[model samples]
Target chain A: MLEKSLKGNLGYWAWVLFLLGIIGVGVICYIVQYNYGLGATGMSRDVTWGIYISQFTFLVGVAAGGLMLVLPYYLHHYKDFARITILGEFMAIASVAMCMLFIMADLGQPMRALNVVLHPTPNSMLFYDMIVLSGYLFLNVVCGWVVLHSEYKGIKYPNWVKPFIYISIPWAVSIHTVTAFLYCGLPGRHFWLTAILAPRFLASAFAAGPCLLMVIALIMKRTTKFDIGRVAQDKLVTIIGYAALLNFFFLGCEIFVAYYSTIPGHMHTLDYLYFGLADHATGQVYNNLVPFMLSSVVMGFAGIGLIFVSRYLKSDPLLALSCLLIFVSFWIDKGLGLVLGGFVPNGLEQITEYVPTFVELGITAGVWATGFFIITVLYKIAISVKLENEKTA
Target chain B: MDSSRRKFLKIAGITAVAGIGAPSALNMLMKQEVQASSAGDGHGAQPAAHGGEGGHGAAPVGKRYGMVIDAVKFHENPGMAEKCIEACHSYYNVPDFGNKKDEIKWLWQVPFTNAFPGDESHYKKDDRTHAMQFMVLCNHCDNPPCVRACPTKATFKNADGMVMMDFHRCIGCRFCMAACPYGARSFNWRDPRGSKDGVPFIKKVNPEFPTRMRGVVEKCSFCDLRVKRGLIPLCVEATGDSKAMVFGDLNDPNSEISQVLKARFTIQRKPSLGTMPSVFYII
Candidate 1:
C-alpha cells in the first residue's frame, strides 16, 4: 500500500516538475513580451490577431464543454451523468483558467485589463464577454465546491446548489455566444459578419469540448483504477458526434450562400481563407503553404469520419485517439481561419502579413503552460478529495 | 428580485434595441450633416471664425479648421499634399516604416474623387488623367465614430471642434482604425521615438498631445497643436498662396472656409457611409 501510494505520489511530483519547467520558460517569454510590445508577436495589419486570439477562442469552447455533462445530468435527470459531473465541473474550471490566460497573452497591455471593468462601455460586446466569462467561472467554482464538499461529508448537497447548476447551463451557452459576438458583430469584417455565427460557434463548442472530456475519461479508465464507466463515456461520444455533424452542416450552409450569391464583400473573405482569391501575390502563405486551408481540410475530414465511427467510438482505444486528434485539429482550424482570415488585404488593400516573433511565441507557450498548471493542481486536489471520500465510503 | 426583474425587462427592451438602433441613427445624423455642408457651397463670400473679436475675449476664439481641396488643381500639382503630409508626420513623431500592424500617421493623401463618393459622378478617370487631387486630413465630423468607439475616451472631439487623441490614455485596440471609413487612423506598433537616416524623429514629445508608445492609435487632429497656437493648419500653410487647400470655419459665415464654400462647388468623401467628413473637395 505504501509503495502504491509512493507511485502515485512520485507521479504527482514528476508532473509538477514538468509543469514548472514549462511555466518557468513561459514566464521568461511573457517578460520579454511585456518589455517589448505586441510587435514581438507574429500579428500584423492583415492579421491583427494571430495565435493568441485563436488560443483564446479554442479555450472558451473547451471551458464551455463542461455544460455537456452538467446539463444532461442535472437538468435532464440522466443518473449516469452523476459519475462524471464532478469531472465536468473540474474540466470547466481548468478550461476557464486557460481561456483567461489566452486572453491575457493576446492583450498588448495585459496590466490594463482591469480598465475593462473600471470604465465599462455597455455598447461594446467585449464588456458582455467579460461579465459572462467571469460569471460562468464563478458559478462553476461554487457548484463544484458544494458538490465535492457534500461528498466529503457523506451528505446531500444543500438545495441551493440546484439553482447554481441550472444557471451554469445557460451561462455556458452565453459565454460561447458572447465570444462568437466578439468576431461576428464587428463591422467591415465580411467573414465574421454573419447572422449564424453564434449558432455555429455553439455547435463547434459542443462537439469539441465533450470530445476532449471523452478522451480524458478514457485515459482515466486505462491508467488508474477509476472508471468513468463504458455507458457514460459512450453516450458522451455519441452526443459529441451529433454536435460535430451539426457544426459541419452549418459551416457548409455558410460556404454555400457565400459562393452561390457571389457578393464580393462576403465571397472575398471566404475565398481568401480557403482558396487564394484574385492572385497568389495577394494571399498570405507561410513556408510556401496556406496554413489555414490545409489544416481546416485535414481536421474537417478526420473529425467528421471519427464522429461517424459509432461502434469504434464506443469501445475502441483507437476511436478515443481519433477524437483527441480531431479535437485539436478543429481547434487549430477555428482559431486561425476565423480571426486572421478576416483582415488579409486589409481595408486599405495593403497586403503585409504577420508572423509571431520569438517573444510572442514564448508568451503564447507560457500562457498555455500556465493553463495546464492550473488544471493539474486543481485536478490533483479534486481527485485526492474524491479518493479520500471513496476510501471512507 | 421583482424590482430587479422589472428593471431588467425595461432596459433589455429599450437599451438593447436602442443600442442596435443607435449606430444607424448616428450614421443618418452624419449623412444629414454631410448633405448640409455640400449644399452650403452656393451661399456667401467668407467669414473667418477667428477673425471676430480682434483675437481677444471669447475672440469667437475657437478654430473650425475645415479644408476645401480643389480636385482640378490636383491635376496641376502632382505631389503638393506630400509636403503637408511630411510636415504633419514630422511634428507628430509618426514612424515611416516597420510593423504595418501598428504605425502612426498625422496626414497622408487619399485620391480626391475616390475620397469623395457622394457627389454626382460626372467626372470620369480619363477626363482628369494627369493626376488625382487628394483629401488631406481629418474631417473633425460633427458625429465622430472614433470618439464613440474608443474604450478609454482617449479619442474625443474637443470643445474647440478638433477630433483629438490622448496618447497616454490609449490602450491600442485599434477599433477606431477599423471603424473609420476613410482609414484616417494609425497605430504605433513599435516605439517610434527613434532616428531614421541620421535624422532624429520624435525630438520633442509634446505633453498635451503626447508622443505615443507602441500599440496605441493616433491620427490627424487638424494640427491641434498649431490651432492652439493661433497658426493656420500646417497643411494649409504648406499649400501656401497656390491656396489650393482652404482652411476656416463652417460655424462662422466670415471664416475663410465659409467664404471659399460659398464661392466653390465642393464635395466630401463617401457621404453615403455617413461619417459627415468635414474636409471637402472643389473641382
Candidate 2:
C-alpha cells in the first residue's frame, strides 16, 4: 500500500519540473520587458492598454466564480455543493493570485505598486479594487481552511462562521463590478463610457466563472480516484447555463441601446467591435480584422445553444467543452473587446493598429503559469488536510 | 470583534486629536478673517487681508496666465508653433520618441478643428494637401478638471491662476489624464527625465516639481517655473514681443492677456465644455 501511494511520484515531480521550465523561459522574457519597458508589449498610443489588462479583467471574473459557488452552498444551505465548495475556494485563491500578477505586469513602474497602499487614493475606483481584491483573497483562504478542517472532523461549523460566509457572497460580486467601474467610469472612451458595464461584468463572470469551475470538477474526476458526485456536477452546470443566459441577454441590450439611439459616438464602438466599419477613415481598426464581431457572435451562440441542449448538459465531455468555449468567448469579449475597442481610433480620432510583442506575450504567460502554480500548491495542501482528517476519523 | 473594537477606538482617538489640534493650527496659519461669502469668493476684495503685506495675508499675487493665438497668422507661419512647442518640450524634459503607448509630450500642436470640433468654420478645403490650423498649448482653464481629479492634490491651481503639477506627491493614477476634455494630459510611460540631457541651460530640476520618472501624468504648466522666477513664459520669450503667445493676469484689467482679449476678437477652445479655459485665440 505504501509503495502504491509512492509509486511513480517521479512523474508528478517531472510534471512540476516541466511547468517550472516554462516559467523559467517566461521569466527571461519578463526581464527583457523590464529592461526595455512596456513598449516591448503590443500596446501603442491608440491602444494604450492590451493583453495584460484584458487578462486581469478576465481573471477577476474567474476568481469571483469561486465565491458564487460557496455563497449559494453555505448561505442557501445547498448541501449538494458540500463536496465541491473546497474546490471553489481553492479556485478563487488561484484566480485572485493570477488577477494580481496580471495587474502588476501592466504597471509602468512595477515597484511603485506598493505605493498604492502607502498613499491610497480613496476617490479612485482602483483604490477600492485593491481593498476588495485583497479582502476577498483573505476571506476565501480563511473560510476554506476552516470548512475543510470541519469536514475532516465530521463537525459542523460554529454558528459565527455563517455570518462571514454570508458577507463573502455579495462581496464576491463587488470585486468584478468594481473592476468594470475602473474602465466604464472613465469619461472619454465611447465604448466603456456606460453605466451598464459593471452589471455586464458580473453577468459575464457568473456565466464564465462557474463554467470554468465545472470543467475543473471534470478534470479532477478524470485524474483522481476521488469521485465528485454527478448530482453536484449537474447543479453546477445548471448554474453556469443560467448565468450564460443572463450574460447573453445583457449583451443584446447593450447592442440594442447603441444601434437604436442612432448616436454616432455610441454606435461607432459597436460598428467597430461587432460590425466592421469602413476602412480606416474614422474607426480604430485599419484593415478591419473583425476579431470581435465574428468571435462574439459564433462563440456566444454556441455557448447559449449548448446550455439549452439537454444531451450536451448531461454529457460530461460536452459540458466541459461548452464551458471551455464559453470561457474563451467571454475572455475575448471582455479582454480583447473592452480594451481594444476603447483605444481604436486614437484620441486624435486617427486610426492606428496595435500588435503585441513577444516579450509581452512571455510576461503574460509567466503571470498565468504563476497563478496555476499557486492553485496547484494550494489544492495539494488542501487535499492533504482532507486526507489527514479522514485518517483521524 | 476584537479588530472592530480596535478600529473603533482608533477612529475616536483620531477625532479627539483633530478636535484639539484644529483651532491652534487655524490660529497660527490663518488668524485674520474677512467678510467673504465663501472660500471661492475673491480674496483680493477682502477687508483685512492678513499680516504679511497690507491686509491681504501671505496670499500670493497670482497671474491668470493665458494665450491669445492668431490662428490666421499661425496658418501662414507654421514655424512659429514649431518653435514655441520645441521650447516648452525642451524646458519640461518631454521624451522625443517611444512607442505610442509610452510617448511623453508636454506641449505639441494639435490641429484646431481637431482641438475644437463643432465650432463655426467659414473656411473649408477639400484639397488633400491643405492642413488645418493648429492650437499649440494647454488651455489652463479657470475651473481646471485636472486639479479636481488629482488624488494627492498634486495637480493644483495656484493662487495666481496657473495650474501646476507637484511631481513629488504624484502617485500617478492617471485619473487627471482621463478628466481632461482637450486630451492635454500625457503619461510618462518611460523615464522622461533621462531625455533632459540634450536641452541647454536646464540642468537641474526642482524637487517640488521634480523630473518625472516613468508612469506619471504630466501636462503644460503654462511655464509655472518661469512665472515663479518672475520671467515671462519661454514660449512668449521665443515670440520676441510679437504678442504671438500672450501671458498675463486675467484678473487684472491692465494685464497684457486681458488687454489683448478685450481688444481682439478672441475665442477659447471648446467653450461649450464650460471649463472656462484661460487660453484664448484670435482667428
Which candidate has the highest TM-score of all?
A: 2
Give, for candidate 2 chain A, the lowest lDDT window spanning 10 residues: A1-10
> Over 4 Å off in model 2, which ranges?
A1-15, A277-289, A310-313, A383-393, B1-65, B98-102, B117-130, B141-163, B166-181, B192-212, B251-254, B258-277, B281-283
Local accuracy of candidate 2 as per-residue lDDT tens digits, A137-163: 877876877676676557886676677
Candidate 2, A42: how far from true, in Å? 2.6
**Residue A156, candidate 1: alpha-carbon lDDT:** 90
The candidates' DockQ values read: 0.17, 0.22
Candidate 2, B1-283: lDDT as tens digits: 3999979987997898678556545653442353333444765553222212221222234445667776666666668877887777676666665345566666666664555544525325433212556664567767665665554556766656567776656655555664666667776655555544465222445344446666566778887877879888777777765667778777678987778888888777666545677788776
Q: What is the interface RMSD of each candidate, in Å?
A: 6.7, 5.3
Candidate 1 residue-wise lDDT, A119-231, digit = tens:
55655666688789888888988899788778766789889888998999999999999988877765555677798988888888887888777776677666566676767
When only the first chain is scored, the TM-scores of the models are 0.92, 0.91
Error of 2 at A141 (Å): 1.6
Candidate 1: list runs displaced more than 4 Å: A1-7, A279-289, A310-313, B1-68, B97-102, B110-148, B159-162, B178-182, B194-209, B228-231, B247-276, B279-283
How does model 2 score on DockQ?
A: 0.22
